[model samples]
Target: MSTTPRDRIGLVLSGDVLEIGPGSRPFTVAPGANVQYADRAVEGGRDQNWPELIGQPAGVQAHYDLNLDTDGLAPFRSGSLDGVVASHVLEHVANPLEVIAEFGRALRFGGKLLLVVPDRHQTFDAPRRATPFSTVLTKHREKTTEVDEASIRDFCQAIYGQPPIHPTEVREWHNPAMLDADRLALHRRRSIHVHVWSPEEFASLIVCSLLEGITAWRLESMYFSDHFPARTADEFALVLEKVPFANPNELGRQFVDAWCNSVLDDTAIDPVRLARFEEALRRDCADAAINSLPLQLFAAKHAALGMASTQDRITSLEVELKTTQIRAAEAIAQGKALELSTSWKVTAPLRALRRLFR
Candidate 1:
């Protein structure tokens, strides 16, 4: 029997799962599952995307008062949860790294975190720049608690953010008149797409977060979806595992080594990118392990993806040589076949006469 995408995700998650912002459509990850929910403004919540929720007073009732943006898992004790889920919620939160870290704090050593965020290219955030991993890392490091104004502005402006239509027509765009103090406060409270990222960009951010000690979870797996089992487009999903490590450096280095090894297996990977990722590994050799990592800047595959390598160039040349040799052999065979098909019994005297006439 073929397993569905939901089934695959459900398998990764086990025991005491808390799904944030479940709204109207709560996933059935397990049979007889007592999955708890966390979301603010639960009384009047309704999701337009799910028609069943349209007429309901509350789409999915929140059983917990937990909030990711400010009081991230504050009600839950450390190492209490088996899995933490935040679906389509990160884009709305300003303190994503902090919230993620909070999730890590709440999860047990073998617990998991399932995250799904919008694909900037397919969403109203198309016009915005991918959120910088370094900036978020700094904010996490500083223990930032407030949403930045720049992000709010970008979401509100959303200039030419999607498709070939008029700039103002995008779903993300807000009227300039709505930019007053009270409205901005409400926007900051939640329900706006404030962050944009490609799958690669977000992957880098998550990996960097682990290395930077912003989160205790390591990247277990991730994928970008155009549309399929969920019938949703322009979204990427990630599964993270909370590993037991005495210090961030231990698990971070181990994860990097594994990533580098896996990347080497892919013959198509650009050597330069691989080399850069390896360089990050090397730097930790003589230095303080955690501090040596650039973390937010190209710390993983995404940063390494942007360069060239001698081995890759050599491989390219070898493929070219093989192609040239194949072409030469084909040309020679074609010439011989033409000669054989031209009537092999032509006389020398006829050929001489034809030459004389010319």
Candidate 2:
């Protein structure tokens, strides 16, 4: 008897199963067995080929938004699901901690969860731009546009540069209430990235969530490191097995938070420093602010239009301010020269009379 690839994969789990965000491509399961797949679009009366995709002899059940963090896990509690597979899905969720907790609840004791996600290290580094507090606030205000369903699509297209048809269908299933419009808009501006995880960070999140449960949890195995070249860019797979009890890493959690907070604080713009900069400009030249107004205006316009980050706008302003100071200094020098040339003898007699009076 020959074992099929699907059989090899399917053998990893022993009982009832759930797959999250299967998307258009479905995983192959064992023959003559039932598995359940959940997605938002499937629940919304959208056409889905889940039955054909699962391809199990007994067929598969489908649920919409079953795996969402906020959604109640009554379905899983109603019956035991031994396994849950999340593929490239965790990154999109607004609050991953909630989702992980739900997964911990859904799984039976000693069940397994398989997760595949993009490697944060492989993605482009988040941009380093310093923006003014006032500018950031103004940008946030501008983001509160009228909420039209089509507007969401248009915004998506504008940010992503085209309609991402494949991801859009699933993304639309996201409950509107779960999304804070203002926060989402700010996030879109910042970079559609809410979380970037290294392998250690990702694993730590899972382990911490599992500690809330009585079930013991252990990381089973990791797949596709250095061996598969294509996965080097986007994805890595982790298998976590349910256990009796596992200790959550309190120190690790604190460390991660402290590190991230330090990074953000270091990157923040210092208003006091900027004030000092303005004072220096004033002291260096008269009319410094006036002469630099046009450049400052240009930079402000660029920032308003979202063409430049706050840091870039500040740099532009500083350049203009310095130029104004230089021009003012030259004007003062020319004025002093004119005063000296205009009245030599007359000024001397006036100076002698003033000295005699003193």
Candidate 3:
């Protein structure tokens, strides 16, 4: 059968299926059963028949909110499901690795798992913060408040009129109490931005997680939506195929080793650069301490020195200042004559006075 645009964009399923974190609108997969999982539905009601939108056959049944993750669906444990479609759901899950593992477990060998996640590089509406390791450590030492998951969810609901749901569970690894109210309040001041992954980093993490037995297999290919014309970045889809006979432990170790090596090589810094950074730090510290004296102290010291140096010159100015006073005396005499002419009948009175005086 010809694949539809949604299938090309996401999972192209042919039979029985599972859809994780479907939110409000579950994907439409005709001729198959679709199961969706989410935390909360719209207040008025939940869409029990959301799968009908996918135009499934009349006998096809739809199950909603099975809460599979909380229900203990293990990797490689679920009998073969033909396909799995997870769309815009991974970001809200606390442990995406476990969810992916569950998907791997549920799929039949050669079965496809289609994952769609918002590209952190392109998604701006989401709350995100990226801090360096040093800054993170510093904040930890300072005992700053942090925002937790529940508050974040509440914030999302308040701002976007939607409940905040984490797509991945990895963030929970950083702070498990993110869902709790009291704990959330303690960290509420600091953004609960526990994790934000760039496109490359996200792909690498997924690959590493699968290789590490967090999932039962590896991804066959990952496609980004941002580079749609040339390269997509806003959303990404990963096509994963189940590996029936793989050793979980060995695969995990090898994956970890490779991931570590890649990260080290990519982020490695030279000795010269390190030395220069340390030297710069020391110089900045010294300069900051030296410049820490109060402003008033500097102003007072400058004022005293200036007064001492110019004391004699200021005294000499007192004598010359007396001679400069003549200009003021002449100006005062002109002012008295103008005032008398305006206040009195100056034309007749002043003339009579002048005649009498003469």
User: Best candidate, lDDT-wise?
Assistant: 1
How accurate locally, in lDDT, is each candidate? 0.66, 0.48, 0.48
User: Candidate 1 versus the native: TM-score?
Assistant: 0.66
Q: After TM-score superposition, what is the CA distance of residue 55 in candidate 1 from its true location, in Å?
A: 5.2
Q: All candidates: CA RMSD in angstroms?
A: 7.7, 17.6, 20.2
**Model 3 C-alpha lDDT per residue in residues 291-355, reported as the tens digit of each score:** 33232333443454356448878878876787679778888998887767755554767778899
Off by over 4 Å in 3: 1-6, 9-11, 23-62, 72-77, 125-195, 227-233, 245-358
Q: Write the per-residue lDDT of candidate 1 for residues 1-358, one digit (tens) a residue.
A: 3254543665577689999988667655655555899886623333422233345656587888765666888888999998888889887776778888788899999888888888787777777877776666667778777777777777777743334443333333355455677656655654677667765566556656666666766667644553244546567677888876556665665566545544544553333435544443443233465455444433445544543455687889999999999999999999887667645445646878899999
TM-score of each: 0.66, 0.44, 0.44
Q: Give the count of colliding residue pairs in each prediction.
A: 2, 4, 31
Superposed Cα deviation of residue 316, candidate 1 (Å): 12
Pick the TM-score winner: 1
Indicate the residue-level lDDT of 300 in model 3. 42
Model 2 gets an lDDT of: 0.48
**Candidate 2 structure quality by residue, lDDT tens digits, 1-358:** 3243222443576567788867655555445445678864323132242222234443244565553534545566832778888777666554555455456677877777777776555543122111122221232245422223333333343334324333554344333443466544433322233344544445434433433332245655554333344344355566666554433343223323332332223423222322322333233223532243233433433344343366688999999999999999999998888778857645878888999999
Q: Any idea what lDDT model 1 has?
A: 0.66
